[model samples]
Target: DVAFLLLTFFILTTEFKQPDVEDIVTPSSISKSKLTEGDNTMTISVTKDGRYYFSPTNNPSQRVELLEKMGEKYNITFTEQEKTAFQNTQFVGVPVAQLKAFLQLPEDQRKKYKGSIPMDSANTQLVEWVQNNAKINREAKLAVKGDGGASYDKFKVLFEGLRDIEFYKFVLVTTEE
Candidate 1:
């Protein structure tokens, strides 16, 4: 009885960490170095279908603050409820212009939305998002999680977007081969 109780207590107390971002098959590299997770790290994911998602950190308040700053920069206003929804969001893939509508959608509908922030020469929402987040957290490190099947052009666009903001240093998240 005592051993069973101890086992149950330990099992109940154990914390199981789950991946907050969407699952994407990352490219493999020979390097065995692992990426460390921290509050100062920002992860940007590119899905195989070319959708982009951004997450500054796992902290809700920091994410909200980033969203607020972005809103202020673009002259887009977010309500308290919208701010709360954004705070609870894991990775936002929509452009700032559509963020209000995206947040207003039902959770299931939002998940089904396959839109990504435009990265074209005329549309530089992704670049603006990265720049805004960097301004909010000066010490934050940028990491890119590109899908293994993602096209080179997509990555080129991403690199160009970063270069536009003079952000040359960033880590490419890959798994050991």
Candidate 2:
């Protein structure tokens, strides 16, 4: 009974970390540096298929707030349900213009939609997302996680998008080999 009581107490007091945004096979590196977890960090993930996902570490409220702000800027109004869905979403990869439609899909469908956010000169939604988030919180640290099998051109586009907004400093997320 004492062991059971102790286990229950510890479980109740411990904080659980959120799961990773997606299962990615990150490129390996020899660096031993560890990533610092905080509410002010933004992780941008690129999948093997060139899809992109943006997530602010440990801050669901901030994600929802960003969505709301973006909606207002684009003259798109999201329902409470949509806002809640955004909060629950681990990462956002859809364009702002299609966010409403994306949010309306079932969670499973949203997960299955393998579309990448456009980061070209003609379509600058990715740049706008980063710029808006930076405007809201200038101190937010940025990190890019690219899959080992992903193309370099995808990353170049992402870098160019950031450069357009004058954000030149960002970390690359990699695993120790």
Candidate 3:
């Protein structure tokens, strides 16, 4: 039946929101301007504790390539199956060293994986992750979704990381009342 096929198509194509998606309360804003969505946006979610999670783009191939680049940089090799798992992940917060084990977990457990990419001066993995992803898609836009309770200092550090890579402009995800 055409109607059955149509419903199946929609279900297969829809990307379900991750149930354990980062728990962050974005500050409310009244701005009318909106950032364009789709594969062009690369979002970094910051929790109240200042933990940084790199959210992959909606494109699965792009996400896989992004993970590959990160793995190569950290001297960690990811198998084909692990790469596939990484692509399907909603967001990755673990350090490069732990990425392999993180990806190997079952889907439900992967969602429970708790980690954060290092964004400090000594680590700089955060900038590397963004840089590699940007290389994959030159048109990608950067955005930060910070917790409402997160301190300005945490945000300042994140901005500085982006600045080191010559990125000055970015969207701030906010909730509208």
Candidate 4:
């Protein structure tokens, strides 16, 4: 009787709340792979235009800024090492650090950091260029699914962007058929 009374009290007093969830759809792939579940893991989508969109694993509604955020967080645009890497290759894209610094600076402050009275419109264009191309389209775990038609070059850029953000384990979405 005593145990039953305690159990009743506990049950009555306890509060239960269901967590909110979002719907995320991933495309299937033929290759075998595993899903990574976590709060930090993110799913990034590489569009045909080379735009990237990503969301955290647990919360799909939370939109990620993708490259600009990464470039800001990792200081990729200002780092000397990234600059050196960019200079070494001709076809290589802009130095990650340069991009980061450009993105990090405020519109008005860019001129001060850039060391000139009149800001270079070209540099400003580059900053806008970075922000314009990246976007988060949907809510889902950063678990990425790609169509077979996804290009290798575009994929490489996506990979580099992921690497820039320090994500090593990615849940590659695929189908059995």
Q: How high is each candidate's TM-score? A: 0.86, 0.85, 0.87, 0.34
| lDDT, candidates in the order shown | 0.82, 0.81, 0.85, 0.40
Score residue 9 of candidate 1 by CA lDDT. 98
Per-residue accuracy of model 3 over 8-35 as CA lDDT, tens digit each: 9999999775443568999999988887
Off by over 4 Å in 4: 1-41, 59-142
How much is 146 displaced in model 2, in angstroms? 0.4
- TM-score ranking from best candidate downward: 3, 1, 2, 4
Clashes of 3: 0
Model 3 CA lDDT for position 155: 89
lDDT of 2 at 133: 77
Q: Which candidate should be chosen as best, given TM-score against the real structure?
A: 3
- Evaluation by TM-score, superior candidate among 1 and 2: 1
**What lDDT would candidate 4 get against the real structure?**
0.40
Supply every candidate's count of residue pairs whose N, Cα or C atoms clash at under 3 angstroms.
Answer: 0, 0, 0, 14
- Candidate 2 matches the true fold with a TM-score of 0.85
Instruction: Encode model 2's per-residue lDDT on 32-92: one tens digit a residue.
Output: 9888857788888888888788875446777777888889889999999998888777667
